[model samples]
Target: MIITLPTILSIIRLFAGFLILLGFLLLARPAADILAFVVFVSAAITDFIDGYIARKFNLVSELGKILDSIADKILVIMAWIIIITYYEFNSWIILPIGLIIFRELFISGLREYLASKSLSLQVTFIAKLKTTLQMVTISLTFFSGIIVDGSGSLTTFLLQPVAGSGTTLMEMACIVLIWLSAIQTIYSGWEYFKTALGLMGTKNDG
Candidate 1:
């Protein structure tokens, strides 16, 4: 495939995901948090921009589809993997993270199966909403974890509750959103599975 703007953006996102993982691992200073945040948010923005450009310019190709999906999975899945590694002992965190990963893999396999039959699974509105919610939730969680780890004034102002709860309010909010996103993930996965079944039935009929 010829190099295009959207493909270039997707490549950038793929590199951004690597940078995020490296920042989280090798960068020990508090400033590393800022680096991670910048790279991650930039990548997230490109995700939307690439899709819009591809559709608008009629540049969507088979390679674009594969690269786009790979970039997205690398970004979000790697973020979740790193997060869960730190919180492996916490069941609450692990459960939602596991669910999100499983849903992605399941849907991907379903899509591949349909593609083999010359059918395509179009993204749904709910799936887009779920992706947005997940991106926001992951971003906040990453930011808060860094701030909390650093124990800076920003954390005090944003995370600290007046009542002095054990868990910071921001942390609580992130966890809640994670769970909400996971629930939506399951729902959307179900929808995809249903579509796959429908397609399978149609294929069998003919």
Candidate 2:
């Protein structure tokens, strides 16, 4: 089996996800954090580009599909775990993470079963939208820490201590986005399960 550029890009994205996870856990130098952010963002862009190029250039392959799915799951799960670690370990993150992980496992199993039976499940537009929201929310949350570093005039203005300020407004905005993403995650998971179940039932009837 020949390795293609898309497959290689997927691997890079997976590795970058692990790097981001490590950066979150280690809390190393600020410089290292910035580097991790750069790598993660670049990998994410490649993820989009790889799929686009693969489809556009008629280069899609089984290995590319597998690697792309693996890359996406690793990046999302790692991002959720890292967010929870940084945000004081709330159960809210855990709920969405569990739903997302379980849904991925369940859907993957269903897909394999269907494939064995010579059937295919179609991806829906809502699923794509859910993914887009999740990616944006996670990326924002990942870089939200920089808002407190006093880098820009806006950051300094926003970070200014109120009479009894404990948390910055920017941090609050990140939290809101994270929660909204979680809601989308749950909705998407439910939607996926419904679609899968319907497909399975139709296959069995056929």
Candidate 3:
């Protein structure tokens, strides 16, 4: 518990997740949605900053790693759930989100089990790409909602996709990114599981 700068930043990101949740709950007010958006974006930015600061200044620590992971899950999963609750969507959106959730939980368990045996499952570049894209998708969705709907009404995203061209294009890009993230999520999750299994001497051949 050295409480380094990166550790403090990670802690702030963790609390920002809850604040984002609070703002989303009060989305009846346009300002609340804005609040959530600001917090979400700020948290995402801090995520990058903390990682850079930790590496550059050698502030990385076990506590910081654990806290950063937990904060990421909270922020991403919470935002996904709120998006689902607010917007209307088809399987194109819902299915991807489902896959993302499943991947997160399953991979987290795999990591824990491996850790118990003093094993490490390294993260792949594609997995990092998936996470970044997912966050970007979430950010764009909230921004589009604010600009397209403009009143913070909690209904009608995909339900009324006939909004102007700019917003519609933005919505389409979000949908594409969601599916891409899901595909990478499954791929990365499988890779991690395979690596973990090998570490445990139970590597799957199929």
Candidate 4:
């Protein structure tokens, strides 16, 4: 496989996902949460950079496409795991998390089925919007945890308004957006399945 810049970036993104997971496991409370957010944000930035560079320079390749998709799934799913583990036990968070996971797995299977036929699914604009919402919600949720129970003077000073009741508001917003993103996720997944079904001749002809 060619070692293109975009491919290298996708590999880095995969590594960054592991680093973010390591940060969550090794670092202490507020610091762990903070580190995860910082690493995740950095990884998200690179995700965009790699895609743009690939499209602009025509560096897009089959390996790059597969690696990029795998990298994205790793990063976002890891973030969701962190969020589920850290957030307070509640149906609001749990339900959306479940939906998101289901969507990812189901759509992954759909994509694999298409791949077997030498076909690929086109990513919809709504799917991109869903990803942005998921990333923002995860970042905000991570930040919310850092200030949730009051991270003392330093964290408080840095977050100012993000402390006190601010954490609650952020948490609420995160939950709401998570739900919205899940809805979009299901819609996008359904679109993929519909396309796949039509292509596979599984759709009944009228």
Clashes of each: 0, 0, 0, 0
Task: Give the backbone clash total of model 4.
Answer: 0
* Residue pairs of candidate 2 with colliding backbone atoms: none
Q: What would the per-residue lDDT of candidate 4 be over residues 20-118, giving only the tens digit for each residue?
A: 789877888888888888888888888899999999999999899889989989888888877887666566677888889889988888899788877
Q: What are the models' TM-scores?
A: 0.91, 0.86, 0.84, 0.86
Clashing pairs in 4: none
All candidates' lDDT scores?
Answer: 0.84, 0.74, 0.78, 0.81
Give the clash count for model 1: 0
lDDT of 2 by residue, 1-206 (tens): 88888889998887887888677567764554575567767877898899898989888999899889888888877777777766677676666666666666677787787788877777788778877877787777666665556487887766665456566766666667777776776777678777777877898898
What are the per-residue Cα lDDT tens digits for candidate 3 across 1-206? 47999889889988987887787676665566678778888899999899999999999899999999998888899888777754465565678889899999888888888888777788688788877887788887777666655534443544345456433555676677777778888888888887777778853332
Can you give the lDDT of residue 47 in candidate 4? Answer: 87
Q: Which stretches of candidate 3 lie above 4 Å from their native place?
A: 27-29, 89-91, 149-167, 202-206
Best model number under TM-score: 1
Task: Put the candidates in lDDT order, highest first.
Answer: 1, 4, 3, 2
* Stretch of 10 with least lDDT, candidate 4: 159-168
- Using TM-score as the measure, name the better of candidate 3 and candidate 4: 4
* Model 2 residue 189 distance off true place after TM-score fit, in angstroms: 2.0
**lDDT for model 2, on a 0 to 1 scale?**
0.74
Worst 10 residues of 2 by lDDT: 28-37
lDDT of model 2, residue 194: 79
